[model samples]
Target: MDKYTKIIEQIKALEADMVDFKIVDFYGRLRHVTIPTTNITDKKLQFGFGFDGSNFGFAETGKSDFVARPVIKDFVELDPCLEDPTATFMCDVYEAAQDVKPYESDPRGILRKACNYMQSLGVADMATWGPELEFYLFNDLLVRTDPQAMSAEIISDEGYWGSQDDDYSFATRLPKKGGYHSVPPNDTQYQTRVEAVRRLTSLGYDVKYHHHEVGGPGQCEVEFNLMDSMVAADCIILGKYIIRNTAQEFGSYASFLPKPIFGEAGNGLHVHFLMKGKNGELVFHDPNGYMGLSKMALSFLAGILTHAPAITAITNPSTNSYKRLVRGYEAPCNCCYGMANRNAAVRIPAYATQPEEKRFEYRVGDATFNPYLALASILMAGLDGVKKSLDPEGKFGPLEKMDKGWEPPVSIPASLKEALEALQKDHQFLLDGGVFTKGMLEKFISDKMQDHLRIERTPHPVEFEMYELI
Candidate 1:
């Protein structure tokens, strides 16, 4: 009769032995709980199973109890990854109190609230996002972090390293930065990517295309069609899951690390977004506007550029993220926008000529981001820009005109600490509509600061190579 009852009935039809409940943790990793299907009832589906929130880094030990309530809409009767017939559902975390409430820091919940907030305003009833998920597929990956030995070895059958070994080498080993859209033989991960995309298609995703990326070491990309904000974020989370699982099945490893290989194009989760007005009109397109972007679109672009450093504190929170953001890798190093300019933080895609297709891409993010937080932060900042009518024309760019000696007003933060510090000073926008609370921001900053310090104190393998002679 009810949605949960309907979901239970559907699961029963599948005759699944177990129900797999999956949730995204603070760091964007998937955490799961399994229960026999016999125990699944409507009440269980409604109330959800309990878990320790502190273990997810969401609360202290004293206040760690939380509920992982499954979303009825996310129920999947057949999962392609699992060999067994197990029903799977994605979950949203909530407080396990007498008066149950949505967890404020829950990444998914935060994005949901942001979407609702956007709709509450008269400007837009819905926001759609198209995200490009890029990652590396490795044939072999090894890492040692011991005090006596610290090193990482990444072996890609399609890379030049494969050429050194006659036994393992393929005839078409890819040279550094040479794998973009490469065909078979050179693109050794082709079947793996195709299989991953097939699984995604089975899971109801509209994949645009997938191909080898510029990093000849097996870097690949999978682009998905535009969907609602929350759905887009969920797609990224589960997309990575299916990809990683599928890679393992093929005896390979899929890594979303921003800069897994030095001197190569890095992985980026470039997002393109456009809002729909109350009348269902595209809010970002204008034929008379600069490069066919409406005033509201420019304002949105300004918001992202203005708050990019702060947003990067969440989107590119890892230390290795900076390694990819540096110059010469096409990663944005400046807070600016340009028509089809890959070097700017935001770029209006050259091919998006139609009203529905017109949208600006945020180029400064990576797969290391928690999709929910990363996307929500960008939306909040853009909404704030809309509220203020922030114009980026003179301040940020149409950088193509820089042949006359133009200088950027802002530079992207060069380190994680700098980005976090920017977040500390410029986070009032994130607090709009109660999407993000001060406490949540504080926790995120403190936790990331600890991570940065830990990495700083550790000795890197490159350190030995550089300082051993001294």
Candidate 2:
């Protein structure tokens, strides 16, 4: 039987009462509808279920009608905590009239187009990506933003900064930035991480590892298995969902905010990627070459470095993201690459010893990005570099040594304004295959600029403390 037919049958056999047809929106939010399991048939999957797109920040109120076509390959079982047994499936948005797939405007459609573009260029049939999911687990989170008052507070029982006050436990606490690899009891959230990993693995995602991060307060990271860019993006969305839900089960909250706390390590979504041929051979591996990187691979790295600043507008969209990219915090602020250098925008991980295992990690992105747009944009930039043979002169340094004299010809943008400006000027590379259209680009820029203005007009709570004494 076909995949959808089998899935429907399995849902029935499992006594599932509801099925959730879900999709990740442009802002990385999960949008879905829970319908009776009886309604999930092969024909229904083919025709799609209708929804209001306006609420999703996608359409005008008058023309908000849209359809969601199930991507059966991206299906996964729902968590058992819900009242009814349910299965969730990722979907693609389609226009109501002709039932045609939406273009760049639809986040999922953009990912599809990027995949097609890759095929068109004969670059690679698939690009695999593995994103290291880092987040903060807090005991309590409170926030208020108003014209009269603005403040935010977070509490963590295991936080290094707050642990000293815990008279209940006399256990010695690690100093600031010393939380990495701390053992059980001191780690505090070890069981939480284990549960999160277990849940993710049960949902068919391969669990690489889970551990406490450098952030003292319940900061942790869970690494998922690598898959094609599209599938990987879907996993990222689902992974975030599972992490948050699991945290709630433990009476805690998990946040993917780039910088959730001051004077602490920031969370990052470090993405490792590999381009391979259909034969399952590593196309980017050249052991005899520098850093075991092939010509195509070097060109791809060059393209990414050249477009790194512009890509940030989408990859690190939020204003708060800039706070994490500051120097001395292990954030990648420079447009450069090196072997095993976490501070570089791109780093070739030394962990991969086999030929097929070789890949490069782009360290600049955070979890705030829409995975579909971010991955597609990065691929488009790389493809453009290959097509034009764009050489990233002096951008990549030796793997073993630090090149103090080396400076990137193009500097990465330090602020959202500069990043947006870079996007405005350097987005032609993203337009070659129409993976990212002019209209969508314009809308994205306009929307982000509006967000920038909103934050700029509002005075920060810290500003009051600084000026109140004056």
Candidate 3:
């Protein structure tokens, strides 16, 4: 009958015994509250369930009250791990009050506001983002930390050291830089990739393809078809959930940490985006321009490169993310664009010929990001570029070794603290059309700095390896 009734009917027909509501906090962590099916009601859908906002890294303890409402369209059945059939729905959060409104810090709401703001400015009708998510699957991971000792280790059946161990005689280990698209025996995670793809597509993710990434220690990647900004963010969360849980079921641990291994390629969530003009025409295509990108597209690229230091604060927010953003390992550290150049932070893919397909890829970001904040920040930067008519060609030259007077644009922020400081100094663009509030930016920076402080105080096991003799 009604929308809420239809949702209940679907859950009942699926034989779901429990309904789970999932939400994303400011730092992009997934949190959930599950209720038995018997508790499902139209009134509950309207009013939502309460949760402590402070626990979610948002409000302070004195003001920690929030509500979560189900996004019924995002419902899906759980994998067969549970004894009872369970359904899950991604949720939107609200401030807990007599007149509840969208929570300003709710990651999803932030993105929505960004999209609406762009339309209000008449920049574009829609934005589409395609992500190439990279990660690792380890056979096992161990960590031991105490006041007196700190140690850690990661074991991958595909690691080069495995052949020397007594467990396996077949030397299936891939070299540090030689794991991309390697065949079976060497690439032991092929079947596991298939499982992740099957689970993702079954849940409505348009997984284009999957393959082994360039890391010897079980690094992998999955590419999905482009979806609008909001849908892309939603799919990312779901895709990550599926990937992590799938790896667990297959007797492995999955990590999206940017730099889980040293001296090798790191995992990144590289995203490609294109926009639609107000006339409903794809705006990125221009055969006459460089890489068939429209003027608007180039301008968008300029915006992103100009604000990259601040954007890094949102896109690659974690401290480990900096390890991946550094100058080696094809990490895209330079603030330049090239035709399919892997070293440049932004590139116009030469393969995309169709107008709708022509887009630019930002290679600096990693999967540790909150997709909402990351995508929104990038879009706002691009919109600012369009407003300013910034010419990318003038900013940086084509991929070149060196020239007498040549210098790339300002380099990426060296660390999380540096990125945060950049955002603090130059975040006025994010305030355009009220897309990002001053409070949200301050809270985000304050909260994320804790991660940096936590790592700064801790002694890495590597430190002990070097300093124990000293």
Candidate 4:
């Protein structure tokens, strides 16, 4: 039998009761349709499946039809979270029009187009990225919001919020804001985090490690090894899926919100990544250069700095994201680079001295981001810098100028609306190579504006605290 036939036979052997065809919407939520094993066949596979795009925050009701074509290599035996004996695959969406092209609103397709643009520029065979995924596990959550009532509360098992009230002798609670790499007894989510990592490993992800982060309130981090741009994005999507579900299995809810707590630490998805040159050699490395970062890499970084204001719309996309990126938190808000400086938006890790190990950490983004748009926009920015020969030396980066009172090239937008406004003005780089079309950008901006307005219209209960006295 052919490759397709072999795949069908393999699925039949597994006796899968159902298969789920999944894809990510523009906002990064996984959307899927389940099909029973009996309905899975060659004819159905070749013709693709139909779905309503309007419901997915894509098209209008008039043009809602879209096609979902399965990516065969993404097929895997799913965790029994869904129906029993089930399989799932990630899919690419196609417009229902006559041309049958990939949908412009599809973030995955956008990333593919970005990769193609990079290859066309002859800068590198491919780019690579690794994300340090950080999140929170809340043991209890309560929210009451409406015209009638508004309130919120969260509790973490490892948090010292009310440890004195807990009578259990085995309770493991850390001090206020001091949960960094805490050992098993001190880290309440230790087994749950390990189980999540194990699930990822079983699914073929190269999970680096897992630990309690510095939130001191059940904040956790799981790091993964570097992979190619597209695969890395996929891994992020998949990794988040496994981690969240595993947390739920242990009776905790996983949240990727950048600042879930008021005064405690927040989550940031710091990326440590490198690119490969045309010859497949590491492009960021240069023995003669400072911090082993080649001149090309500096230029690429300059591109990122140039576009940092706009890229924030994609990286830190939420209104609450601004709460985590404020000063006094060491969450890089400056558009500059430095050697191992936690305060710098882009920092070259001092520990990575080997030629092959040369890579920079972008500390601005968080898990609230859509991995596809986040990485694609970042790659496009770097490519623009390289193409324009933008310099990150004294003019753009290199740590010393900040002390000399040299203003950084740019600053991060303080609000989601501000970031979207920057994106609206500086999205020409994103428009290059037709990766992101005008219509897509327009829709994204319009949809995100609603989020900003929603928060604006809501009345925070905190107003009552001060105003009631007046």
TM-score to native of every candidate shown = 0.97, 0.94, 0.95, 0.96
Backbone clashes in model 2, listed as residue pairs: none
Tens-place lDDT digits, model 4, residues 291-328? 88898988888899899999999998888999999877
* Superior candidate under lDDT, 3 versus 4: 3
Off by over 4 Å in 2: 1-5, 74-76, 80-83, 163-173, 398-405
lDDT of all predictions, in order shown?
0.89, 0.81, 0.85, 0.84
Give per-residue CA lDDT, model 1, range 82-107, as digits (tens): 98888988899999899998998999
Tens-digit per-residue lDDT, 92-162, candidate 3: 99999989998877889889989998888787899988989899989878878887877667888888766
Looking at model 4, the pairs that clash are none
Q: Where's the lowest-lDDT run of ten residues in candidate 4? A: 74-83
For residue 182, model 1's alpha carbon misses the true position, in angstroms, by 0.2
List the candidates ranked by TM-score, beginning with the highest.
Answer: 1, 4, 3, 2
* Candidates sorted on lDDT, descending: 1, 3, 4, 2
Model number with the top lDDT: 1
Q: Please give the lDDT score at residue 373 for candidate 3.
A: 92
